[model samples]
Target chain A: MNKVVLYMSMSFDGMISGHDDGPGRGLGVNGEALHAWLSDGGISPGSHRPGVGVNAEVFDEMMQTGAVITGRRTFELAGGWGGDHHDGVPVFVLTRQLPDQPAPGHARYVTELESAVAQAKEAAGDRNVLLHGGSAARALLDAGLVDELVIHLVPIILGRGRRLFDDQGHRARNLELVSATEGADVLHLRYRVVSR
Target chain B: MNKVVLYMSMSFDGMISGHDDGPGRGLGVNGEALHAWLSDGGISPGSHRPGVGVNAEVFDEMMQTGAVITGRRTFELAGGWGGDHHDGVPVFVLTRQLPDQPAPGHARYVTELESAVAQAKEAAGDRNVLLHGGSAARALLDAGLVDELVIHLVPIILGRGRRLFDDQGHRARNLELVSATEGADVLHLRYRVVSR
Candidate 1:
């Protein structure tokens, strides 16, 4: 069965991106440190991405997903990942205000949450649907739509910024650790969301 | 010289204890799950502590610390750990108002943060002084006094609870991973505070 997995790079203090994360400064002020491990082996010329060697393992695995879903803010800030997140896979975006003209990429915006997830799951077929952005991840997690989490737990504590988990409510969530891998100055933790 | 190390057990969502943590309820609602790994083999009759076997590794390591420091709220809630946090080690409580009668334990109340820390460190001799509770840890960390962090990363997320990292300003703190050990159901992560 296919799964809906969230891939997020978070600092030890739980910030997904530093404060002041907007259109131009996507990762916020000092949030680049969270993703520094990705560029440890320098840019991969073949993939044209900032990840190689052991550091790129997670990125490589993320690229293999059949489809991707993102929240509007992240989609706009990241410029829709130039249409295709990976391998021209369908990018399903959740947003209330849909753009009139689609940006340069392969993103399809939807208003409702379930619709976006359902379409993304269908588009993914037998492969997993890559969940992107903290907003979308939180929403999916709160709604119990996400199946797994692939968190690149960075060692730094960015005391400010957008958190992957916040303002959700007082509902306790349970996650089972599936795997833990050591990366270059990072820990790649995979967890199965058991309860929401 | 002995270092000031913070020993904290935090949930995956960064909660230290659940909501309604006061007076009698120290761990708060559903917060006991975080410490469940410590008693996997049930309570140890030898030490009269709730930790035994392989799961008690961190607990055993924690028990060896010479002295301890804790915040006023947590200190009062835990009843000052019956005055002996461990082996009759001096327990320093940071509070503005000193109690008229000390609780039947070995706790000494101090008004200032530095005094408590200094006394605890000096009392510890060559052994490390354990920084107990999130409030004291935050104050010490903000003042650049904390040297190391030993976090027992629990897998569950209690959505409503007291967070160790909340309310602190947006100053990014850097930590170098000293070691990462896999426990029964918890990940024992030790990090050296490089910058506050």
Candidate 2:
């Protein structure tokens, strides 16, 4: 089975992105701080930017995913990831309505949550699906669709912003630790969702 | 100088304790799930409980602390930790006013944040001070007083609860990764606060 793994960079307080994350300010005020690990490393072949230590390994693994799924807000913020998120992989955007132009990329808009997850899984085939965090993560976790979670725990406290897990009527979920690796500016933690 | 360290077990969403975590319900509904590792390990000498794998080592280090500082609410919630939080060490309870005939234990009430931290450090001498999370942790972080943070990153999401880090009017703070250790039910991450 192709696992749908959710990856995000979060602060010590759990903010995935900073406050005011929208069209004008995609990552919000100082939201890019969470991705400091990617900026502090030496990039080898097939790597995006420069990621030091475990950040490089984690980013490499994410780049190798077969497909990418993101929510509408994040999709718009990223301007559709130029249609393909990584290495010619299919990008599936979960949204209620499709944008007019979609920034000239290879992203396909899907209306229903189940359909998007199913199509992304099928597109992934043998490789895993790279799921974005924030609103999309909450939806997938609530629906019991995420198979694993890779949280690059940033060593800072934004104190406020968008959360990754949830704050609504969510029940207790169980997970098993797959691995924990230290990056230059983050702790790379991998957990397998056992039960929701 | 004695270092003031904050330790907390947090959910994937950054909640330290679950909803309704006061008075009667200490850990809150299903909040104990974050502490499964403590219950899954063998009881080694000096450990508070049976902690599997890294949990035992973490617990042992926590028990060796010379003093404990906690907020009034958490102090009341733990029923004062029988007055001595661990091994007869002094307990510094931060509160606006002293509790009338507080729970039987070795707790002293301090009305000011600086005073509480100072007293804890003085009492600890060369040993590290174990500062509780929640309000005290937030205050210490905001005041640029905390030296290190040890987060036992649990694998569950409670959805709603008290967060360890502040959310209102808090600036970004930087930290350096000291180590990352994986336990049976949690990932033990130690970080040194570098910037405020």
Candidate 3:
């Protein structure tokens, strides 16, 4: 089965994006610091910048992902990922309405989350389906569709922002820690979603 | 200087207590699972039962703490630590009103947070002053008084609860990860509070 994985960068306080995260800003106001580990020429597709430590490992893992599913806000905020999917993989955007003309990359829009995840999984084949954006990931986790959660735990605390898990009355879920690795400026935590 | 350390157990989603956290229930609804690591005859002052791994380590660390300061709600919810301190350490409860009579085992009440912390620090002497609750810890952190923050990161995700960093509009603080240790059911994370 193609595993549905929610992978994202988060602050030490568990904020996925800063308070002002929106269309113009990808990660919100001070959130750029959260991705400093990747700014040093790490794994960000096409740019095979020589990276070391956990950044390289995370890059290699992301490179192997088959399809990416993201929220409409994240897709728009990222400018449709610069007209191309991350490493040419198929991208599915979970949105209520689709644009008249789709962008250049292999992007698809779906009104429903389950169908978007299903289509992403089908597109991913045996490879892992990567869920991007905190809202998208939270939706998947709430639906019990996420098989794994990988967090790049940045060491900074953005005291106020959009939290990764913002569901007010969501159900409790159990996670088994699979691995914890240290990077230059981030802690990579991989957890298997045991029970939702 | 007596290091002021904010130490608490937190859920994976960063909640320090459950939705129904209050008197008679220390961790709140369904939060007992978070402290199962400490229930198996580990370090609890009088319990000298043979314990190994993280529970013992936490016990030893708690034993070394000279004084503890906590919020009024936490103190009341815990019933004044069952009428006694955890290990006979002087406990300063931050509250607006003082009780008619102080609880047993060196418990003191202070109307102000700064004075409570100061009294705890003074009582601690050269030893470490421990902040015992999420609200108390946040107050200290907001005041730039917390020198270190130690979290016992439990793996369960309580989707809805009182978060440790619930102070919205609070200043963003930086943290340096000093250590990360794995326990049976929790991950012990020690971070140096970098800035206010």
lDDT of 3 by residue, A164-193 (tens): 887467779999988888888788888999
Q: Model 3 over residues B92-161: C-alpha lDDT tens digits?
A: 8887778888755678788887787888888889899878887787777888888998888888889888
Q: In order, how many clashes per candidate?
A: 4, 6, 0
Query: What lDDT score goes with residue B151 in model 3?
Result: 84
Task: Indicate whether candidate 2 or candidate 3 has the larger DockQ.
Answer: 3
lDDT of 2 by residue, B1-196 (tens): 8899998888777788878777888788767776666667465554356545578778878877899998888888887777778888889888877778664677888888998888889988899999985888888888998999998888887878877764676767888889988777688888898985
The residue pairs that clash in candidate 3, if any, are: none
Cα-based lDDT at residue B92, candidate 3: 86
lDDT of each: 0.83, 0.81, 0.81
Question: On lDDT, who's better, 1 or 2?
Answer: 1
Q: Is candidate 1 or candidate 2 better by TM-score?
A: 1
Identify the runs in model 2 with alpha carbons over 4 angstroms from their true place. A41-47, A51-53, A99-103, B42-47, B51-53
Best by DockQ: 3
lDDT of 1 by residue, A1-196 (tens): 8999999999998899888788898687779898888777566554534455556778878888999999988887877777877889999888878789764577888888898889999988999999989889888887889999999999898888888888567467788888888888888888998986
lDDT of 3 at A129: 86
Residue pairs in steric clash, candidate 2?
A41-A52, A83-A106, B41-B51, B41-B52, B83-B105, B83-B106
Can you list the residue pairs that collide in candidate 1? Answer: A83-A105, A83-A106, B83-B105, B83-B106
